[model samples]
Target: MSNADSSTKKFASQADLEAKKTSFIKLSDNAYAYTAEGDPNSGVIIGDDSVMVIDTTATPLMAKDLIRNIRSVTDKPIKYVVLSHYHAVRVLGASAYFDEGAQQVIASRGTYEMIVERGAQDMQSEIERFPRLFSGVESVPGLTWPTMVFEKEMTIFMGKLEVRLTHIGMGHTKGDTIAWIPSQKICFSGDLVEYEAAAYTGDAQLEEWPATLEALRAMQAEKLVPGRGPALLTPAQVNQGLDYTKDFVTTLLQSAKESVAAGMTLKQAMAHTRKVMDPKFGHVFIYEHCLPFDVTRAVDEAQGIKHPRIWTAARDQEMWHGLQAG
Candidate 1:
């Protein structure tokens, strides 16, 4: 690629400079969502005696602001830090909770394995890809290791409220987990669902994702705190988020399958996928940053590559330049 073409903007999210104001929305009496425009979101679940945080922000410094928000609502200690998956942007800030007296960091077995396998590489890759999101990267001490891990599901109670954490099939990643409160019909879906923003599918299980959405819908959640976008407070809004995410995943995978069937190259598949998806999702946040990665994964899945390759900072540039140059 030419020097001008290989500028920072060509890499994923390198040129994104806008600052987004954070929103702390109450989804129910016990559940809340911390969203920032279209950035990754964190969920707060407050029970009678303690609190459980779902997905810490990108760094310890960023999580401090979330802690301040939690203090505004309840003084209960943050007893648990639940990771939805092992993404750097999602789990790196976990130590901040431990500093604030969080008793344990929790995740699924698959997520724990991912951390052991690719945590370091993903951290470096993400920090370079989205500089603004990792504004406090220096504050991240190291990989956030989970103190507790479950197989399929586990339930915990804080005073009267019961929080259900389940490995609801894989979508965004192989170890996707969701926090569900049965009594309130509320769920904290990590990266499994994105409302208005683009779904980052670089590490996704595309074929299994739609069925996972069905599993999420079966909960009949009245309130949902999605991974990105504003909190869904009503049942209708919750359905909309699920449907939008399903459509995005379905469309991308379908386009990629067709490209593969026609024996198209990766760059050609990406172009074709964009031609189909841009009209609908182009206006969404991080659509440009997400599509290249999304299509690359879709193409891989279509060609029978079940697991996504690890993305290092160097691999990210190579892929971007190769795809964009073609």
Candidate 2:
């Protein structure tokens, strides 16, 4: 079947789209994280004077659920909303936060630039790639632009709460950042740490992923809100999340490198990878959506490509066909 046909098969029905809603999981005192049935995760921190929301879902309509969840806990205004990365599914919902009186929407300098350069393209690609996540596409006003951009790291004080935004290194994306609460030992790892989910590495720096995880380990977090899956409540579970992420990246890179060294096509590489990864990570969230893209990008990077190619709708179709053909 053609890629266009695959698109029809993948998203012809919006059954999955109808299931997105906010799930309030309390991480600590005066702190909670909002996760949809499986949408992008958002965090809420209620300080002495105001509030800070970590990530906004994908659309204003989707963010209303997060807003409603926050209202249940406190009436304090959302003073800040932090973007963990530049992915449209994560930041496009910033407008909802703005209406809630969020004083600043923060991201790293590289992430800010990415939003300007490729955010629109990414927005289009992702909407098609994961239709369920962008349920109310019309609700998105425009590309999500960051108001406050940081370089290496920035610590913002919301009343007495210290929210340390740190650029540990490039892993998931060029400008990946994590929100670390030193006192509580809780780290809101963007896509850097995934729990029970496949790590999406289309724009990932696979070589640098292990080191980024190492930097995260050095922080000794007792609790963490990973990019996906359930929140890690214990240090052991946090470490498990980090380890699983590292293992997936490492194995993917190995499969790609080996397949390319023997002159195999991207499809053959994916098949080999599927054989190796199925018993372990095939059950993870988005494992199928992420693996083909992950392995395809890894093969290109292993063949000496420096930067990841821009993912357009046409390219997505092409890649989808390649996967289906195999």
TM-score of each: 0.97, 0.94
**TM-score for predicted model 1 compared with the true structure:** 0.97
| Regions more than 4 Å wrong, model 1 | 1-12
Show the lowest summed lDDT stretch of 10 residues, model 2: 8-17
Clashing pairs in 2: none
**lDDT (tens digit, per residue) of candidate 2 on 176-237:** 98998888998898888887878899988998889999989989999888887778889999
lDDT of 1 by residue, 1-326 (tens): 23246444456477787878998888878988999999999999999999999999999999999999999999999999999999999998998888777998999998998999999999999999899998778999999999999999999998999999999899999999999999999999999999899999999999999999999999899999989999998999999999999999999999999999999988899889989899999899988888888988899999999989898989888788778665
- Measured by lDDT, the strongest candidate is 1
Candidate 1: minimum summed lDDT over ten consecutive residues — where? 1-10
Alpha-carbon deviation at 123 in model 2, angstroms = 0.1
Model 1, CA-based lDDT: 0.92
For each candidate in the order shown, give its overall lDDT on alpha carbons.
Answer: 0.92, 0.83
